[model samples]
Target chain A: MLKNLLLNRNLTCLFFILIISSFEKIHAQNAQVINFNSLQKIYSNKSDTTYFIHFFASWCLPCLNELPDFVSFSDQHKNEKVKMIFVSLDMKKDSIKTLPQLIEKFKINVPVFLLDETNADKWINMVDKKWSGSIPATLILNNEKKYKKFFSESMSLQTLNKLVK
Target chain B: MIKNIFDFSLLVAICVLSLGFSIKGNKSSYDFHLKNVGGNFVSLKDYPSAKGFIIVFTCNHCPFAKLYPERLNGLNSKYKNLGVPLIAICSSDTITYAEDSFLKMIEKAKNENFNFPYLCDGEQLAAKNFGAQKTPHAFILWKEKNNWTIKYSGAIDDNGAEPDKVQHHYVSDAVDELLKSKKVSIPETKSIGCQIHFRK
Candidate 1:
């Protein structure tokens, strides 16, 4: 009986270890590092999905201030055809730990990605030749990849709604 | 066939993406008369001796701006004698971010032991005229017959987060070329930094 109990406890510990690691893996995969070209393909492809991509950084105060509104907006429109992505332009170094913390801090369920690019000159113009490389910028795209708009500053839920429509 | 199709689609997507907005670039530099941290007014035209100006839109609370204090100090002390003094601007709305108030700016200047004036853009006059969107956004201006013409505008260097690891020197090289009476080689560069907290 004693031996059986000990084996059961060991199995339970192994099970938890597996679950925790898999959870971490899923979360890691969710925040997959992407560049401008890769992301252009995903949102600009031809389907019926509306793409709302918001650029933010952990260090940006304005980005932090208006994030909850964006998150709640996304939550409220969960069933809609709109797909929201929160792109964290945070430096690639600390984002592994910091991104998770910020997500947990706000209890955000929206998918967040880290824009993994170093050469700003090449990629900045690619996104929108006119983007002055400002944070809290946003991009909304339609299925045909024709109806697209870029906001170069912090926006509210009302602004977000109007853009989606 | 796939290559042609891919290229054609990308062109269409880019045309659609870049339709509405025009990215701000080189233009005539704007003149300003704003108060420094010391409560005195200063204007760009006052520096008659300077061959040009390094008007950098910066503030106290920005991490990117904070990293450049030593660099700014060096730029001023080294080039002030060369007739290219650096003028830093804080365009952040003080009402929204109390840490960026004039009082704190003075404290920050004192703590940093600044050699140059750090002015407060009380009304965001300079920021708007120059179309400056980010803190630590640098513009290298060279004087023409009378007016100062903007020659280069963008980041200070290739890297804003790390200094020692920087490979390209954008502002310094431009300044050096201007001092030598030669046209700047690479006119512009870009980097990530804090957006200016302008009030709606």
Candidate 2:
């Protein structure tokens, strides 16, 4: 009977440890706030790697809807030298908490960076001249190796596949 | 004498380059015959009685746009009789964002009780012509002798998240200056908004 009680206690402790670990996994992925210069540095650092950069804001409903699509696309292209990074336009102070929550909710492990610049016009044209300072914009670059493309809208799975290649 | 001429030529080139950079490219407003939610066709030239019009590129689903339904209503009610009525256009591509389709726009207008004509830019021609980057973008046009000329372009206010937190009333201020026969002090201001999804 003593042995049975000890086994039951051990099982309860194991269950609690599992629950704590899962919680930490869900909540621990924090987003870093990056300025325009830093953002440029990141892309410029790896010229040979294909980069699929997505810009989104927390309040944008269309952005929220397409995020899962972006995650899935990144998953399929993980081994293809394509690096997908989500740059959020959400305020750094608020997004630190919300972004990870969203990542967990979507069940997608992805790199998210909060764009810290408030002067949107400064970087909007830098991203693409055709971009009129809009959210849910995606910019794809193969650096100096290939061509770069910018799309200023929410894209579907088919459109995403077509544009990435 | 040669050095003086060279300096003058360089100065002219500098001035030209500065001028080119300062003024953003301007495309004359496109002619649109869009249907309002009431199934009424709204043409820019239809408001002959008004001295000017407030053309707002807005949609139903954008969160920032949603914050200003009451404010827009207030603007229409307060300013329509003042000769600057509001004309809102939804230019999102209907195929991707079905909530912004013509029928959905009608239901939303009914629900919001939008007093102004909420027109649907089915082909997004109006948005393209106006260079509207996002939803809730406003362009103020004043009747200039024979034709309407765009005078002010940008956000309605500084805060789209909360009305009470507004610091700048860009549309109201511009309209006020126009009413007083004065140039708008701040002609343009950038706004935070959802990008208008255009079809490829």
DockQ, in order, for the candidates? 0.33, 0.22
Candidate 1 clashing pairs? Answer: A130-B23
Worst 10 residues of 1 chain A by lDDT: A118-127
Q: What is the TM-score of chain B in candidate 1?
A: 0.83
lDDT tens digits, residue span A17-124, model 1: 999999877666657788878887878778778888888888888899999889988987899988898888877877887888888787778777888876576677
lDDT of 2: 0.82
lDDT of 1 by residue, B86-154 (tens): 999999888877888999999999999988899999788689888788888999888888878889999
Q: Which stretches of candidate 1 lie over 4 Å from their true place?
A: A1-30, A93-97, A143-145, B1-29, B38-40
Of the candidates shown, which would achieve the greatest lDDT relative to the real structure?
A: 1
Q: What DockQ class does candidate 1 belong to?
A: acceptable
For residues B1-200, write the lDDT of model 2, one tens digit per residue: 99999999999999998888654343454447999999889997787788888889999877678878888888888889999999999999788778898888989999999999999898888898888878889999898876788899888887665568676788999999999999999898775688787778
Tell me the alpha-carbon RMSD of every candidate. Answer: 14.3, 12.2
- Number of clashes recorded per candidate: 1, 0
**What is the C-alpha lDDT profile of model 2 across A107-163, one tens digit per residue?**
666677888775554577788877766778898888768668888778877788887
Assess each prediction's global lDDT (C-alpha) against the native: 0.83, 0.82
The C-alpha TM-scores of every prediction are: 0.78, 0.65
